[model samples]
Target: MLRRTGIPLLALAVFAGPALAGCGGGEPEESAADLLSRAKTTLDDASSAHFVLDSEGAPNSGTLLVGGEGDIARPASFEGTLNVRALGSTLDLEVVSVDGTVYAQLPFASGFSVVDPAQFGFGDPGALLDPDTGISQLLAEAENAELGEERRVDGDVVREVTAELPGDLVEQILASQDPSQAVQARFSIATETGELRRAELTGPFFTAEDDATYTVELSDFGADVEITAPPTG
Candidate 1:
């Protein structure tokens, strides 16, 4: 999802982190198209699943409990709630897995603002993991792909694939660019099953001394889920 700062570098990293961290393939002379296509296939085969969204971004880091249900047959949603501490106090942000719909009720803000998860824009779990309208189009946006080393996830070794951003994605990210700076977005996927594990966001979002890396751990499933709109004025 979109990073706090308007910096494209930071935004691209955070948004593309999933593809960068988990999206990879088994050892082989594989093309970028083949790897991405396979990743999409794995996601297409998933009926239901869950993960924890742990983000190391501005403000603080915490686990975002998430779970999903239904596949291509029935439409369902993954829902989660998290207690986030920013400044000196704590606020709750409710993340909905229906498309990119995220409802955040902050103490300072008037109320929840239904945000388009796409604002994060690198095929967030809400969309990529959805049974409908998944990473097919999003994959087309990739310009390059490379298979990295095997890593341990969930105690199992898995291949990591890094997908470089195409010109369109770069343009989309650079739309808000500053002449003084520039950056690229990458998407990593799991080589074995294409499940998104972690996402990292880095770049000029913060000052030279500030930390720009962010990680979101995508858990907490099998319970009943509901996403009611935040109360309005």
Candidate 2:
């Protein structure tokens, strides 16, 4: 009776060993370059997305853009509010961009008026989602990309990537005083969807003497968003 029981148990153990090994063997993790490529493709394919921009360690003086939150639609359309720091005061301005025209309702103003985006120390927000000159471009041009540990962001599993971006490339999206200094960029991309969740940049954006940090959070991809030029009357 003992011999018979021992033989059956040994056979069962041999069969279970292979099955257990197979369970642990899934697809290999993606390389940092490949992951960034996928993320860039995902952003380029998105029709519309919501974004929030924030900055830290900015100089106390001078006219600077500090924060902004808005929705951007493809083919150049954006509706959002920008926080500008001028003369030690933070001014919130409502802005709209459509058809290559930018309009803003300045403080103490009755209505929107045509304005140049650079006057506020920033570039056109509407072009942020443009495939050629937008955040996707940064991902495509990242150098020495390296994947970091995964973390949970806003309830989504995301993998972090560390890389360096050319200051000239960054200047196309935001204002930069020195385009010769390289910017350190950290990107958090969603593992499941390949969508870019957050981007942190550190460089000499406002002045060459000091390095400031800017953080951008992106979400709400493919949302039903309609952006039209505001009446300037």
Candidate 3:
């Protein structure tokens, strides 16, 4: 049993630093729409990036660490380690998407199995930002957005923005093949470069008594990386 109340993900921002004004800008800064729009443009322009995802609470009820470098464009692919929570161990997992097909490297009797994507908790990794219902589109759908304190992270000023998300937006970010919950996300962006540093998403995707939260950290934004298909056994 858990309390219905817990620290909202944004609460982490308070520890950033003394409250400070927005980042220095001569253009009076842009609206969330414009800023995110440009950031989306930047992300869309990128061919690949390295990413890590940490999530917990109701739905999973266990800690999960999944990360790897992959292409951001359609036919997305990623090679990384997925800690086998049940076994209390970690294993290498490779995910690939070419055209519209998505597949994963699963375990098969001391060997590896190239199976469908569903078993790995993903419906379509490549379409996560499909320009229609992707993260960029989710930000485009953001409402009640308010800027929060600006603080320095690794010497770069990061700005926080909170907003309520529509159901579809919430589901789209889910790591599972199934997602049917309304969501809200706290966004952290780089003030100087308009780069998205982190995103914390909260939603009621688990059950009535509990909620789900996903913390996604995106880094190495424009690294040149190629995630190709694994060898056939």
Candidate 4:
């Protein structure tokens, strides 16, 4: 079983005030919005990063192993396991989204298949952090943004921020609500490096469930990221 995400998944403390600079960076004081915008720019310009998305106990779940690790990159594709809790089974699923198309190795299959990620509860995981309409856009459109206190996350001290996300992005990425429904979002960034560490969205995504939290953690920024369709026999 995958390890739990730990206690850092607290609801980001949202204070009603101007943003503040992160905990340690010896830089000009910046509001939560400024910091987020800067970080978004940094990530948008990067080629790739090792990513791990954990949504167990969430409305949707899944994955794969690279040397026994679940590592995926952005801008085009993701390879990992797809967790099916209802059936208590997991499938090796790889997804690629580029040029308005999605390719994948569906569960219980070996060859690459053209598929839609929306069927898996995500419109497109590859674009979840898109420079334009993904997290970058959300941060740019964030409102009531506030910087929270610094805290340790997975052993590293990170600066936290909480804000309200645009309704459209919430519907697109989390999809826990109707397009018109609004939601809150929180993010943590490395104080020293301004790197985004974690993102949490709290809202309703599943049927009959009032509200659920989906957390996505990112690491290994700027690692080699290469994606290609599976080989045809």
TM-score for each prediction?
0.49, 0.92, 0.71, 0.73
What is the Å distance of residue 146 in model 1 from its true position?
1.6
Residue-level lDDT tens digits of model 3 in 171-221: 555542235545778888887787777778876654444666777777777
lDDT for model 2 comes to: 0.92
Model 1 stretches astray by more than 4 angstroms:
1-29, 44-51, 54-78, 82-90, 95-102, 108-139, 166-189, 201-211, 218-233
Candidate 3 Cα errors over 4 Å, as ranges: 1-27, 58-75, 83-92, 108-112, 175-181
| Highest TM-score model number | 2
| Residue 28 Cα positional deviation in candidate 1, in Å, after optimal superposition | 4.4
Say which prediction, candidate 3 or candidate 4, comes out ahead on lDDT.
4
What does candidate 4's lDDT look like per residue over 44-160, in tens digits?
876666555555344323211111123445665555444323333444466655545666676567677777666655666556556775656766777899999899877788888
Best candidate, lDDT: 2
Cα deviation of 7 in candidate 4 (Å)? 59
Write down the worst ten-residue block by lDDT for model 1.
Answer: 65-74
Clashing residue pairs in all predictions, respectively, total 26, 0, 0, 9
> Once model 3 is optimally superposed onto the true structure by TM-score, how far is the C-alpha of residue 56 displaced, in angstroms?
2.1
Q: Model 2, range 164-185, lDDT digits (tens) per residue?
A: 9999999889867898999999
Estimate, for each residue in 63-149, the C-alpha lDDT of model 1 and write its tens digit: 221122221211344455544444444455554545345554445677666655433322233443443454334454544556666
lDDT of each: 0.44, 0.92, 0.60, 0.63
Top-down lDDT ranking: 2, 4, 3, 1
Q: Least lDDT summed over 10 consecutive residues: which range in candidate 2?
A: 170-179
